[model samples]
Target: MKKLIKYGNENSQYGELYLHDTNCIGTVCLFHGGFWTMPHDLHQFDNVAHELLNLGFCVWNIEYRRIGETNHKWRDVFDDATKAINELNNIKNIYNHVNINNVFVVGHSAGGHLAIWLNSQDLKIDVKKFIGLSPILDLEIAYYKNAGDGSVEKLLHGNPNEFPERYLFGSPIKLKRKNSSELIIHGNMDDYVPIKWSKLYHEKIRKFTDISHLIELEACGHMDFIDSKSNVFDVLKSNIR
Candidate 1:
């Protein structure tokens, strides 16, 4: 059954946990991407959650504070993400059947950036693998290109030149660690987030660690990565195991 649980004080900071009734292999955390803005939330991952459950994995669909919300700050989003994962680890106490280890994170667009960033952090909970679907991995590039209608500036409250430390703290490209494996998938036709971002990021990270990989989908667009019926979903499923 799917259950909603709070991991933070604010209403926006919560997650929906999908617990498989039998033979659950591990946990998968889903993060939705809306360019760090208010228009997106956990609801975007509903279909993905069910599909993960069917694949013998429990799902945690997370929601974090975004810009345009009260007391919203970019760091708060990171804090909320950390809280959600920590809560997921403790969820095994409630369900008893849920596995705390072998946790995988799947993120889309902006959320993919966050997943990569989280994987790089020094957190108490360990993430086994990170899957980024069309992530905005480079904040400096996204800032210079004015991607997402100035979403990066809005989140950082300034350009990368003005807030280099913030960009260093937030950008997955800057924060990537060699501890966990990461697979980045991008559509060749993605107009929202160009395929080059994933390719460049993969190239950069691969130089330091061999665990990073990139997969480019032909004729696929930005949103196709999240579509369960799409070929991208098959690619994602094949990698999850």
Candidate 2:
């Protein structure tokens, strides 16, 4: 069964929870990507959430305030992501069968950035794994590359020189290496976020931890990671365990 659970009072501060029947292997938290804009939402991951539920993992597909929304802030997007993950504790209280301890966070595109960023936070519960599916690892690079057509500048309210601290806080590349196992899967053909950022991030993270891994898919694109019929989805299923 699926339930809409609120993590905060705001309209966007809620997630769709997909529960397992009896026993669950763990919890898989999903964040969808839309360049922090209002055009895309959690509905993009609905198919994948159901697929994960069929695999015996409880799923939390989160929604947070994005640009173009009324009174939206960039920092609050990060805050909402944190609160949504932390809400898993309260979820555990109601659904004891859901394993919060063995949680895996999966994100695509900008959502990948949020997932890895959430891993960097000092949260109440530890994340077992952080998976980025063609995520934006470096905001500075994304800004220069003009990824999302100036979305980075719009998100931080300035360039890297102007708001260095905001970039430091938002970019996974600028954050400390997370203790949790990290996996990044990017397609060589991805024109959206590009595979370069993922490769760069993997090299940076490898200096600190041996558990981090990056996979470059041959003919895949940015949207393949979210597609249920794509091979990237199969790769995602294999690694979540």
Candidate 3:
């Protein structure tokens, strides 16, 4: 295992990444949930990686520039995610154990939103499936619902009014994939992100694809997915295989 940090253009360095043997079943690029803020990354998913490694699977826990980590951080959350995926592919070439045809991503909350968006993205990596735990995939709803602010949203799509194209292009919800490789887990009683956010994304996704599945945790809250308050880990582990 090795902990590596990749530097960015602005003297920012992506945080510690845990890379185990590359010759496992598949490479899972994990993104931790932090709502584009700082103090969040792959460290929170240490237990998940532990469970994954115990199951004889190769895993890569990724961390990148978050809101608090850099001075110019904003919409770079998505950029970091796509960059991590690309980086995973580069090292994967030598190992030859990574399932090139079936790479997986798992994320929580904001990370969940990122994981699903990665699967839907038009990037170079070939994503087999994505496990999203309480994902914030629908940006349009978050905008009108005041869940996300101007500065936070602007970092991604820029000014929504001044650049409608930017909004339309940067939003994964506004885009479509030939097929959805997604497994979404959202709490039915989530007060933070609201269940409707996942609902709206699911509804929009079904129009274009057929492989989206959502697991609604009854009587659960937003943070419960990664918290001990709920048995979300069991659910997440069961789906990992």
Candidate that scores best on lDDT: 2
**Prediction RMSDs, each to the true structure:** 1.2, 1.0, 2.9
Error of 1 at 57 (Å): 1.0
Compose the digit string of candidate 2's lDDT tens values, residues 67-101: 88887676878898889999999988988888887
Q: Which stretches of candidate 2 lie over 4 Å from their true place?
A: none
| Cα lDDT of model 1 by residue, 1-241, tens digit | 9898888789798889998876489899998999989878878878878888988998989999998898777688888877888887578878888876778988999999888888787777778898899999989999999999999999988997788999998888887585888889889999999998888888888888898889889999999877888788999999987
Ten-residue region with minimum lDDT total, candidate 2: 67-76
lDDT (Cα atoms) of all candidates against the true structure: 0.87, 0.89, 0.69
lDDT tens digits by residue: candidate 3, 140-237: 55666666444336455444666666566556688675364688898888877888778888888787677888788888777776653348777876
Candidate 1: C-alpha lDDT: 0.87
* Cand. 2 Cα-lDDT: 0.89
Tell me the RMSD of model 1 versus the true structure. Answer: 1.2
* Clashes in predicted model 2: 0
What would the TM-scores of all predictions be? 0.96, 0.97, 0.84
Q: Which pairs clash in the backbone of model 1? A: none
**Alpha carbon deviation, residue 139, candidate 2 (Å):** 0.4
Sequence-dependent TM-score of model 1: 0.96
Clashing pairs for model 3 are 75-155
